[model samples]
Target: MYQLKTKETENSVIEFIENVEQPKKREDAYRLLDIFSETTGYPAKMWGPSIIGFGSYHYKYATGHEGDAPLVGFSPRKAKISLYFATGDTAREALLEQLGKHTAGKGCVYINKVADINEDILKELIQQSVQFLKETYPAEE
Candidate 1:
């Protein structure tokens, strides 16, 4: 069976953010922590070694590959800040256009800093991602 590398851990999110090498990235991480926490109404959690994630959801693919992942998250990397959002949301593209400055991958949006992007747009992305995931993959109760 294949295993997922990124799993929720009991690590300290504050300690992780404080240890961020760059001063700017560290500050941005804190800001993101506040934004994501307030927006998602979920506490910040250490997902794997680096990602600071909000709410979580479980996803199963047609290939039988499934795992629980954060509905929204971000990582302040050395080069750029990576924002994690739902990959299947079509509305993301439209919002990204209005988002000040950023580069996006399949599931991650890279930004130079928090100031470089629109905070409102970021919040919308977070909310949309969370809603999309919840609707797409409801909790198995």
Candidate 2:
């Protein structure tokens, strides 16, 4: 399971954001924090070294692979902001097309900056991803 040592990581995330020399990037991180909180209705917390996460869920597969993960999260990376949607292959081509300028990896969306994307579309993407994850994994007690 991916257990988060929240106390240690939370301060790290805050400091990391605070030290971002680019004023625009720093502001974007704060904006993303608010967007994530509003979308998840859960307070933001750091997950591991860099990710700002919200909520959590447990998953167990038939193959005995099981773990707990943040419901949704993002990390501010040097080249781009990595948005963790946890819906790697769920056919979101339509959303991606409308998401403005961004690239994606197997399980994450990489945006150079919030200014480079449509905020409304990004919010919809986040909301849809959260809904998809909830339905796919459903939380386990």
Candidate 3:
């Protein structure tokens, strides 16, 4: 199993957010932090170098790949924010249609600005993603 190196907690995440230079980006990050915290009921934490994550789960695939990862997370990128959701089979086509203006890539949904999307729909997406992860991984602890 791949072990997580960084401590997953609020202080570390807050410090990282504080260091963000751009005011708009920082504010967006803070909003995302609040949304993820409220939706997942897990305090925000720094994952690796840039990702802000919530909760965690351990996974072991039949192919022998194993690791522990955050149940949900997002990274504030230069061009857009990348929201992570591990929904391999669960289709979110309906939700995406209602998600407003945005793009997607692999396991990430990208948004240029939160203002361009519906806040309520965003929260619903987070909640649905959390539910999917819980059912797929079924937390060991």
Stretches off by above 4 angstroms in model 1 are none
Clashing pairs in 1: none
The TM-score measured for candidate 1 stands at 0.98
Give the TM-score of each candidate. Answer: 0.98, 0.85, 0.87
Worst lDDT run of 10 residues, candidate 1, spans: 87-96
lDDT tens readout by residue for model 2, 70-124: 8778888877889888665455668888889999888888998988888888788
- C-alpha-based local distance difference test score of model 1: 0.92
**TM-score attained by model 2:** 0.85
lDDT of 3 by residue, 13-101 (tens): 88888887778888988998988899889988777888898888777899987777888888888888888877674556677789888
Candidate 2 lDDT score relative to the true structure: 0.79
In candidate 2, clashing pairs total: 0
Model 1 Cα RMSD, 1 decimal: 0.7
Model 1 agreement with the true structure over 6-105: per-residue lDDT tens digits:
9999999999999999998899999999999999999999999999998899999999899999999998888999999998778888888998999888
